[model samples]
Target: MKPFYEKTIHTKPIFQGRMISLQVDEVELPNGQTSTREVVKHPGAVAVMPFTTDGRMVVVRQFRKPLEKEIYEIPAGKLEKGEDPASCALRELEEETGFAAESLQLVTSFYTSPGFADELLYIFEATGLTQGKVHPDEDEFVEAQLISLEEGLELMAAEQIHDAKTVFALMYWQNKRLKAQLGK
Candidate 1:
């Protein structure tokens, strides 16, 4: 058996929305105790860090309802049913930033919040970006921003880049920079 496994005894679906589903689960703990878990099920997502040929990083600023604020972040979107992560990344890049990537490389895949949510996020580093048409979703209102890598680092240090995926992508970029400098 897996470590600290919780066997679900019952699951009560609370709400089913377009992007996520909420459920309350009654689970039996490994030590034979029963507990309740409020879980958020998400259909996964993809985030891209696109860098222009001129070395500027493309980001987006949008108003988030949950945060009740406009924040800058890397381009990202949810994965549609039966959609691959790379495809989702490319689509989001073009739709949100008006840029198409000539080279799309997967950086990593991670769970956004493993404590109470099952939302997996796939991150990619996109280079050789070319200007394209902007076409975001009907409900999405995004403003693209192109900044240097140093500016992105400053934004993160100023606590402006708050999202997990965006932060991780930036870290990935930093690591790539280090590796390149080290001639690895």
Candidate 2:
């Protein structure tokens, strides 16, 4: 079967910025009606789920301006123009958590918010961690912590970790671990 939403008409960017762009599009609905959809174009991003040798997960505590509060999340960053997701994942992991991974594997990729924004997030699993100096952006402020996988699950259950990307990555790993334990 074909998709329901079809792009009947689209207008190029009215304005562009470092992180996003404004675009207007006309789409045909499933009900055979036409409508306009304003979209925010993003350059996509990468999130890293770093695991220490001792089976601990590396998390970052940062104060998000939009939330106006410190939140715990996995290491993540937006991709620079012409940069690859894997490279971005490695760079962000080291920059945010002060740990470099010898092996980085792509876990999954998904859209952050499909309602209006076109932000695709690529998640990676980083292993073989080695300590380094955190080189966060000058405007960025964050604290890194290494928590056990069990502790991370507890944090999720306690509603302490609320970021969507972080939650998704943790749950994905958790499910994988459970399946492995059950010999499936």
Candidate 3:
């Protein structure tokens, strides 16, 4: 694996924005050749799978401009510089869904799209939720909904829940349930 590594020779910034930046890197390929790779750098993010006391999951419905339609997804937001993922998860859950979790656990973390982007997302499972006032970002227009895990899966099958983070979170939640049922 080390023999196949591409070492970065130089990086040229193409664009920089508040949320993401684009860069092109000149790399020394494993085969002794040089190539350019375009990459998108992001500030990573956190996604929360909030479960209520009655076994319902809290999700958010919002219009995604890139998709040009509304979609349902777990509460998520980009991490502030130097912010811990768990803290970001809790903040996003409360801000978007108006529910604060009494118990929040880190389930996993992964890069959303490693082929071209470096945006990693930390996923958390939150339980024992208490309702509060929603304080979504001024630019964020989101409405929270509570649904059973079964319903969440159904929505996924219907393509209504299409975001990667939400899909992964729901699948993780279901896998945990199956494991519990099997006593594994």
Candidate number with greatest lDDT = 3
What lDDT does candidate 1 reach at residue 46? 91
Where is model 1 more than 4 Å wrong at Cα? none
Each candidate: what lDDT?
0.90, 0.88, 0.93
Instruction: Estimate the TM-score for candidate 1.
Output: 0.95
Determine which window of 10 residues in candidate 2 has minimal summed lDDT. 3-12
lDDT for each residue of candidate 2 in 67-182, tens digit (9 for 90 to 100): 87777899999999899999999999999989989999998899999988999999999999999999999999989998877888788888778889988878877887899899
Q: Which residue segments of model 3 deviate by more than 4 Å?
A: none
Kindly indicate the candidate among 1 and 3 with the higher TM-score. 1
Counting clashing residue pairs in each candidate, in order, gives 0, 0, 0
Instruction: Judge candidate 2 at residue 24 and give its lDDT.
Output: 82
Model 2 steric clash pairs: none
True-vs-predicted CA distance for residue 27, candidate 3, Å: 1.5
